[model samples]
Target: MLPPSVFESAFNSSPIGKYLLSPTPEALILAVNDAFLKACSRRREDLLGKSLFVAFPADPDDPASSTNEAELRASFARVLETGTPDLLPVQRYPIPLEGPDGTIAFEERFWSAYSAPVFGPDGAVTCISHTTKDVTEQIRSERALRESENRFRALTTAGQVVYRMNADWTELRELDGRGFLRDTDSPRSFWLQDYIPDDEQARVHAAVGEAIRTGRVFELEHRVRRIDGSDGWALSRAVPICDAHGRVVEWIGAASDITERKAAEEKLRESDRRKDEFLAMLAHELRNPIAPISAAAALLQRMQLDEALVRRTSQIIARQVGHMTALIDDLLDVSRVTRGLVELERVPLDLRDVLQDAVEQVAPLVQARRHTLALELPSQATIVVGDKKRLVQVVANLLNNAAKYTPEGGCLAVRAGAQDGGACVEVSDNGIGMAPELTGRVFDLFAQAERSADRSLGGLGLGLALVKSLVELHGGTVGCESAGLGQGSRFLACLPCLSGDTAPQGEQDDEPMAQAPAALRVLVVDDNVDAAVMLAMLLEASGHEVLVEHGARAALARAHEARPQVFLLDIGLPEMDGKELARRLRAEPATRDALLVAVTGYGQDSDREQIMAAGFDHHLVKPVDMERLEAILAGAA
Candidate 1:
C-alpha cells in the first residue's frame, strides 16, 4: 500500500542483499541495494539497464556454471509468471573478485535466495525483487558433525558399550540403543552396584564419585555380571561433561570386555611368585654347605692338631665339599636337560649289574643310618638297553632319597623284575611319607617335602627331577606314589627290555691294582695356591717329578723351560685364561705334543667341549678322584 518512491527507497537501503529486475524476457536489472552492490563487488552503473543474465552471466569455460545459472533463472521466471514468491534451496554461485595482480577471479560461495514479483497499478507484474543470504559456514559445520557421529558409531559397533548418565549418575542409558543394558533389565536408573560384582562395587562407586567431583576422567577395571549370569572382567572409562558455567551435567563412558587378558595377568603373577621362591630356596641350600667348609678351613688354619683330630676335620671338609659339588652338578644337569643338550648312551647291559652298582653306592648311607635293607632281584638277569652310568645314578639317587627321608632304623626295600617285556625297579621305604598334594609336585624342579626342625636331611630338591629327566632320556618312565603322610612312599622306574641275547660284556679285571708306569715330568697350573700345592705333593708322592705355578703367565714361561711331558692347566686364571694359554702352548713346538689336561671347577659338557677345542687331551673337574687321575696318567704313559 506504500507509494512507489517510498518502496523503492526502502528496498534500495535494506541490510540484506536485494535487486530489482524488469519483468521481461531479458529480465533487465533496474536497481540494487547497497548490500547487493557490495556482495557482488560491483557498481549500480555497471548493472543498471542491463539484463540480469548479462550483468552476471555463467562462465563460458565452466561446465557447471550453466546448470547453476539455469536453475536461478527458472526460479526468477516462475515468480514473474505466477506473481507469487519463490524460495530457492541453498546453491553454489561463484562471484567475481579482483585479485592483487589486477586479474578478475571467481570466488566460490553458497547462498539461500528468495524472489517475489512486484505488481503495478493494473496488477501486472512489473519487477522481481530478489533477496539472498550466504550460508557456506553453516553447511560446512553440519557436514563435520555428521562425520563425527559416523566415526563414533563405527568404534562402538565392535563389542563396546557406549553409555551416558545424568549429572548424579542415576539415569543411565545406552546412547546407541544397542541393547547393552538388556542384561540389567534396561533399568532407567543405574548404579555401580547393579553391574559390578559385590566385591568391587564400592571401589567403582568411589571412583565415579571422585570423577564427578573433580570433573576428571574415570578409569577402572573390575569384574561384572553379564546378562547370561556369568562373571567377566571389564575395563570401563568415562569423562565428565560440564555446562558453560563449569557445572558437571552428565558423563559419557565406554566399557570393553577384558576377561582373557585378566586371566593371563594372574598366571604371570603366579609364575613370578614361584620363581622368587625358587631363588630364595637356592640361596638357602648353597649357604648350608658353604658354612661348614668355611668353618673347617678357618679352624685348620689357626691350629696344628694331632693326626687323629686333623684327619677328622679334613673328613668333615671333604664331605661338605662333596655335598656342594653334587649340588652344582645337579644344577648343571638341569640346565643341560632344559636346553636339550643331554644325549643318552644306549648300550645293552644287565639290569642286575646296574642294580648291584647302585646298591654298592648307597650301602654306606644305609649303614650310616642303620636302616635295614632288603633286595629282591630276579635270579635271571634282566637285560635292558640303557646307559649303565646314568642308570646307576638314577637308582643311587632314589636309594639315597629313601635313606635321607626315612628315620634312623627304618626299613627299606628294593625289588627288580621283568614285567610285560619291560624291566621295572621299585624302591620303597617306611619314610616320613608325603601328602597327596605334595606327591603330585614331588618331581617338580625345586620341590621338596617338609624337613625336620634342625634340617638334618638336607638336599637341593633336584634329585627326583634329575631322576625323571635321566630315565626319560633312556626311553623310560618314572613315577612316585605315597599312601599319605607318615605311611610310606614308593618310586618305580620302567624301561623297555631286550628280547634277544645281551651284547657281549667287556673283559672284567678281577686282579689286583696294576703298578703305575715310570713317572713323567708333570707341570701343574692353578690360581689357588693350596690346590696347586696339594696336587703337586700328591703327584710327587706318586713318584712323578712335578712343577706348580699359580699364574698362567708363570706357567707358560715354566712350560717352555721345562718342556714337561704333561701339563695340568686351570681354566680361570689372572691376565690369561687357561683356554688362551693352552692355545698358545699348543702353538709352541716345544709343548705342542705335551699331554694337555684341563683341571678346573667347570665340568659341564659344554665346558669339556671348550677345553678340548682349546687343545686339551682331557678335562677333569676340581677335586679330581685319585683313581681316575691314576688311570689317566697310566694311559698317557
Candidate 2:
C-alpha cells in the first residue's frame, strides 16, 4: 500500500469521479474527491455533508431521469446489504449548476456508476464507495448506429435490391435481390458478367468508371439477367462510401426491376409511330385519285374538244371516281368487319364453284399482268359450311393481292386440297417477297411493305387484314410465309370442311336473263346538282321520263306534278335529311306508293337500317354500280 499522503494525492488526481457515502438508510455523502466534485460542477462544501439524493436529484421535468434514479438507489442498497461491490446501469442523471444570475439550474447528463461497501474490523458494512464516468456521447452514437441499421433492413424488405461492392466495382461483397434477381451472400469477382447482359456490360462499365473517377453517385438503366435466365431491365443506382479523407472505400447501391414499365413505354412509342404512318398513307392514297379527277374536270371545262376527246375525258373521270368509290368501300368493309358489325350468311357451298367465281373475278388483272395463272383443285368437289360470297371474296382478294405484288409476267399459283380435316388454299407468287419480320405482321392493319414514291403496288394495306378477319369470322385461319426479301411469298388459308353433300336450298344454276325496265315517270332527288342531272340523263337514255330536283321539297313538288311511278332520292338533303325526307315522301299521297331508293355515300350497316326504317325500299352506296341499279329498276317495274 502507498503512504497516506501519496494515496490522497492519487485519489484526488484520478480521472474517474469517486465519492464515499454513509452506510445508512439515508446514504449521506461523507467525502468526495476532486474529480467527483468537478464532474458534478459543485464545491466540496455543497456535497460533503449532504445525502446522495440531496446532492443529485432526479429532475421531475426530465422523463429519462425518473427510472435511472430508482435503479441507482437499488444498486447502492444492495451493495451495503451484501457488503460487496455492485455495478449500476448507464443512467440519465441531472447535475445542479450555478448560473451567472445567482440562480440554480440542472444540466442534463448521462453516467455509468459503480458502488461498493466498505467493511469494519468485525466484517460489517460501514461506508459505500461510489464511482462514475460521463457516457452521454457514447450512448448517442450507439442510438444513431441502430437507427441506420433499421432503415437499411426496411429498405431491403421493401423490394429494394441492396448490394455492396469494392470501390473499383471489380468485386461484389454482398447482395440481397428482394426477388428481382438472384441473391449473392458471398463475395463475387465476376458479378458484372453474371448479372448484366453481355451487350450491356460495356455501358455499365463506362458508367462505373465515370462514377469512380469523379467519386459521384452512379446511376444507369440497362438490361440485366433475371432469375429465369431472361434479359430484363433494371434501374441501378450506387453511391460511394468514403473515408474521413473523402477517399472512396466502397460502394453501396440499390436496383429496381423496371422490365414491365420499359416494355409498356416501347409499345406506346410504336403505336404513336404507326398512327402517324397510317395517317400519312391515307392522305397519299386519297390524293392519288383526287389528282386525276381534278385534272379530268379541268380538261372538260377549259377545252372545247371533239367527240372522241370528250368521251376520253369522261372515261378518265369515271374511272377515277370508281377507284375512289372502291377505296371508300374497302375502308367501310374493314371498319364493319373489325367492329363485328358484318354478319356472315353461312351456307353449304362447293369449293369448286367458289374457286371458279374467284378466278373469273381476277381474270382481268391476271391478263393485264401477263402472268401464268395456275389453279389446282381436288378431283372431287370440296364442300365447306361458309358464306359463299365471303369465301369467294377471300379467294379473290388473295389472287388480287398476288397479282399486285408479283412482277409483270411472274407466275402465280392457287392450289386447294383437303388437309388436316379442313380445306387449305395456298396462293404462291414468284414476285418481290417480304423480309422475315414482315411475314409475322403481314396481316396487321396498316402493315405494308416499303413502297416506291409512285406506289406502283396500289393498295391501302387493308386486303390482307380483311382476309385474316374474314377467315377468322368463318372459323378459319390464315398465315403468310416468305423465304426472305426478293424470294417470293406464299399465303395459306385453312377452313373447316363438310363431310356430306349438303347443298344449300334454292341454289340457282344460273341467273335469269335480265329484262328491260318499262318506261315509267321517275323523279330523281339529290343535294348535288351534278348527281341529279347525271342520273336523270341516264334514266332518260333508258327510255323513261325522268325529272330532276336538287332538294326534298322540290322533288316532292315534281313527283306530285308528274305523277312519277319511281322516286330515286339522295339520303343527304339540305333542309330535311334523307331519312326524314323519305318518311315525308311515304306520308304524302302522291308519292307514298312510289318506289323509294336511297342513294348516298353512307353505307354502314347502321346507315342501311336507318334508311330502311324510314320507308326506303332500296339502298345504294355511291358512285353506285349502275348495273345493279338497273337490275333493281327492272325488277321493280
TM-score top scorer? 2
- The residue pairs in collision within model 1 are none
User: lDDT for every model?
Assistant: 0.80, 0.81
Alpha carbon RMSD to native, model 2: 32.7
Tens digits of per-residue lDDT, candidate 1, 1-637, equal: 8788998788778888998888877888888888888777676756889997777777666777788899998998799778899999998877666553346677777789999988999999888988887776677656554553444322223355678887888888786535556543453878666677799788888888898778888898878776556787777788888899988788898776666556867967966776676676667778987898888888888756788877888899888878888878888888776545676667788888888889999999999999999988888867888778789999998999999999999999999998777999999999998888777677777666243334457776778888888888777888889999888899999998886477625435533354585698999999899999999998898999999998988988898788899999999989888999999999999999999889988877767887899899888898876666777787778
lDDT of 1 at 618: 86
Residue range 590-612, candidate 2, lDDT tens digits: 77888988899889876898789
Give each model a TM-score.
Answer: 0.65, 0.66
Residue 160 local lDDT, model 1: 57
TM-score of 1: 0.65
